[model samples]
Target: MSSSARPARRRLQRAALPISAVMLLSLASAGCGASVGGAPPCLPPEHTVSPSSAKPGDSVTVSAPDAKCDPRYGEDAVISIVFIDAAGVEVLNTTAPMADAGGFNFTAEVPLNSAPGVMAVNAMPHGVDWCDDTGKNNRVSQGELPLERASCVLPTKPLNITK
Candidate 1:
């Protein structure tokens, strides 16, 4: 990459690190520590993304409280991080839990080939009787009152991608 071509990449990297730290610190400094046997309040599937807008290949920070997400796919307790494209297609990414968090967060890259437009991020319930976005079986027959539950739930907010 040329010196000029590299600025965007470098700026994004610099911006991501401190946002991550602040996320962790803010959670810790909340009224009462969460790990001290006082778990954070549950806000089911509530998610927040830093830099609500970005370019392809840019990193966005997604944070969700563990209280709202059971993280159970069958007996495994699985959690998935995914982005919904302009075409409404979901692109799943890997997840890594913070060292000690009262909340859950994920870092994902906007697909490099993504076309510029408005996209959404969703925390698909891995796979259940209602949702099976990945064909992977986890909770094929779960959830009570299935009729009342939507095919999928959102623990996400919109992320706008720029060219």
Candidate 2:
């Protein structure tokens, strides 16, 4: 090759090294569960419903401890308990703010006219600002969290509500 062409080729080769390094670094960091593009490797929270079997119009207490909610939402986080009938229709929906300890104790009353079959009671954290919106609490689900951001729904378990 010509001398000019040889120098140009060497310059291109030198520039490619830094570009490739940056690309590789980005890809490596993306899979470490540090970003909020998807669900993190957080452990699913445990759900407990008092009086697991209850009649219609009964009061039930659904509690979650060691919840992985962001500290920013420690008191403002919205915790919900939803009951769906066997036919997959919502029978009862109850929501309350997180307790001082970053957990939930939602007391819900079953619908009086609810059907008499097994109902699914799910307790989860809704609308939690994973703190990444503006960098205040930008981390998503890590150890015991369910989602990566407030835009996503947290994990839940089924509680059998009997009639």
Candidate 3:
């Protein structure tokens, strides 16, 4: 190529360097957990029941880690536990508000009348009106409820209820 064309090509290549670097940095930041697409990341919170086995009227503690759903719903999500007996009857239901730091503990007595067998324990975001049983719309188990940034059906974990 001519000398004049060579200098113009060099100038264009130099200008592209900064733009490339910026795009790479943006990608790297997102890969490192920074929210992308101007939306906060939505990670499903996990639930754990201490002891996993409890006797009638015994106290059971449910623990949950920090979680995010929809940014519009923000950080304050209600956590609820539904204790169902072997007969599929709900015996005890409790809703606890989540703390600012996200982690929370909810302790409740296993109803003395809880059908003595393996009890099905389910957890879900109970703060939103449509996502809860108390809401007039009653979409509790619809599985289409939006939780923060994602949609999920409520999840259940099992617990041994001994006599």
Best by TM-score: 3
Taking the tens digit of each residue's C-alpha lDDT, what string does model 3 give over 1-163?
A: 7767877866765563332233234333211112335555443356677778999889988877765543233466666778877656789888887654345688899888887767766665565432222213333353323224222234556678888
Which prediction has the highest lDDT against the true structure?
3
Better of 2 and 3 by TM-score: 3
* Tens digit of per-residue lDDT, candidate 2, span 55-101: 87788887777536323344566766677765567777778776543
Question: On TM-score, who's better, 1 or 3?
Answer: 3
lDDT of 1 by residue, 1-163 (tens): 5668577765764564332243344333212111222433322345678898999899888876654333233334344566766655555565544312224667777888765666666553333332332334434453321132222334445677898
What shift in Å separates residue 64 of candidate 2 from its native position after superposition? 1.1
**Candidate 1 TM-score over all chains jointly:** 0.48
TM-score: model 2 vs. ground truth: 0.52
Q: How accurate is candidate 2 locally (lDDT)?
A: 0.55
Ranking by lDDT: 3, 2, 1
- Give candidate 3's whole-model lDDT: 0.59
| Residue 120 of model 1, lDDT score | 62
